[model samples]
Target: MKNYSILSVTCLIFASLLLVLGCKDDTSGQQNAAGQQLAMSLPVVEIPTKTLTAYVTYPASIEGVVNSEVRAKVAGYITDVLVDEGQKVNRGETLFKLETQSLNQDAAAAAANVNAAEVEVEKLKPLVDKNIISEVQLETAKAQLQQAKSSYNSIVANIDYANIKSPVDGYVGDVRLRKGTLVSPTNQTPLTMVSDISQVYAYFSMNEKDYLNFIQNAEGATISQKIEKMPKVNLLLPNDSLFEEQGTIETINSQVDPNTGSISFRAKFDNPSRLLTNGNSGKIQVPKTFEDAVVVPKESTFERQGTTYVYKLDRENMATAASIVITQEIDNLYVVASGLKKGDRIVAKGVSQLRGATEIQPQEIPFDSIAQPIQKVFR
Candidate 1:
């Protein structure tokens, strides 16, 4: 009976061991199935092949195309000031009146002298013809008349100049001299300045390389005409704000500035709204050549160890980080020059949690939808 009990105990222990092994197998199978289900549910995005444009950007300043300094042309005291600072004046409009007391008296005297000389010359002509007066006397009277005419003309010119007028229709700047200030022809005083802001000028300097390229390609064409094919220029104002008015390329300097080592180029813009101003510092946009490039969302790109990289979604719905060479930027898009291929599935989202060769369930967020805020640039 004791031998039978020992065999029974061994059988029980064998059955118990089998049960433990079965439980472990079942647990392992359950874990594997769960993992497979999770993998299937992961999101993935397909790579896209898109065309992009290559552009070059630089810094530029805003300047007036027509700038003039209003200076006194005649010597006189400024008696009446007709315009104020920031007021617009038309060409030939009187901006100020100089005291004309001495000029008027001189003109009156000239006129009296001219009348008397004409009478004397007429009387002498008859006398000379009748031999009552010598030929020399007639010649002297004629000469006196001519002198009087010249004096009259000179006085008239001074009288006209007493009324200072604007040379062109423009906005008046600061009043350099107040009324009643004595000014002269040789004086360095300027009463005020008027600038034609209807169309302002912007000057910039480009390197010799750019100048050569521009001249070669822009043969027989004006800078304004060339810039018309490009996007409008943006202006940065003194207050650090952007001006809404767009500008165009206007002129190029005939010669490059020797001191600056660059050729000067100018731009113009319609300032009908009086929004733009002179001496404002801002940058402009220039269109360049087109290159075969890949553009990715700025958000999808990340930097590590001074290198730029982007996450790509593989066919197996896994997140893969790729090292890419960035060239230029357009708004929120990055122009990729190398290290990524067209139609290579890229992870456009979840970059914060991504790493190189990471196993993930990639969700295909439509690139358009992901970059909708920035994609609005097209619409």
Candidate 2:
């Protein structure tokens, strides 16, 4: 009876051990299946062709098309500042008035001298006609009278010059001199400046390599023709906002600047509202268009060891890393130069979680939907 009881206990212990091992194996299989399901579902998109424009920006300086300096023509103290800074004025309008007290006194003396000389000439002419005095003496008196008159006229002209006037019809710049400040013609600094803001010029520069490339890509035999054929460019203000008016590239420097090794370019913009002024700083955005280019969203790309890549989806929805050469990056899209083409499917997001040849259940999405809020620069 004892031997039979020992045999029954041993069988029962073995049976319990087998049941626990079988339960563990089933749990492991279920976990593996869950992980595979999670990896299979990811968003993918088919590449599309687009007309993309990329901007190459350079630092630009703004200036009025006509910047005229206001200077005093005669030495004097300013009595009145007729125009305030930023005030709009017309041509020949008085900007400032210099004190004419000393000039008036000098003019009085010159006038007296002219009168005395005229009286003497008249007396001498009568004597010469009567032959009572030598002709040489009369001629000398007439010459002295003419010199006195010229001196009087010069003093009168100087008094008129004391009223400084605007040379151009434009807005006034800073008031470098105020009331009672002494100014002269030979002063190194100008009294003030008048800028014609009806039109403004934005000056920018490009290096030799870029200039050559720009010229070669333009469709013209001459520089002027190239400018005529080139598309209009946009201006970026210092605050990073686009200017309301578009600008046209009007002039290019004939020769490259040896010191800077860059060529200068001038673009003109209409400033009807006078928003742009002299000495304003901004950027010039020169656009280069890529027609019917294959582009991908930046989110779908990753960089590895300085090489850009995207996870391409094969026919079987398997993810494989493919290299791409980027020609230009605009806003949130990359213009693919090589290694990718239109209609190719790429993992839209979650590319980091994928591995080589990993099969996925691609949930296809529209390309534009993923590349939202793209800058519309093509016009």
TM-scores of the candidates in the order shown: 0.75, 0.88
Model 1 reaches what TM-score against the true structure?
A: 0.75
Q: Candidate 2: global Cα-lDDT? A: 0.93
Report the lDDT tens digits of candidate 2 across residue range 1-379.
Answer: 9999999999999999999999999999999988766557889999999997889999999999999999999999999999899999999999999999999999999999999998999888878999999999988988998999999999999999999999999999999789999999999999889999999999999999999999999999988899999889899998889999989999999998989999999999999988899999999999999999999999999999999999998888789999999988888899999989999999999988987778888998999888875667985
**What's the lDDT of the predicted structure labeled candidate 1?**
0.75
The candidate scoring highest on lDDT is 2
Q: What's every prediction's RMSD, in angstroms?
A: 7.8, 4.3
Report the lDDT tens digits of candidate 1 across residue range 222-316. 65565555455656555656666776666667786789778876667777787765666666545554355666777787998989888776666
**Pairs with backbone N, CA or C atoms under 3 Å apart (clashes), candidate 2:** none
Best by TM-score: 2
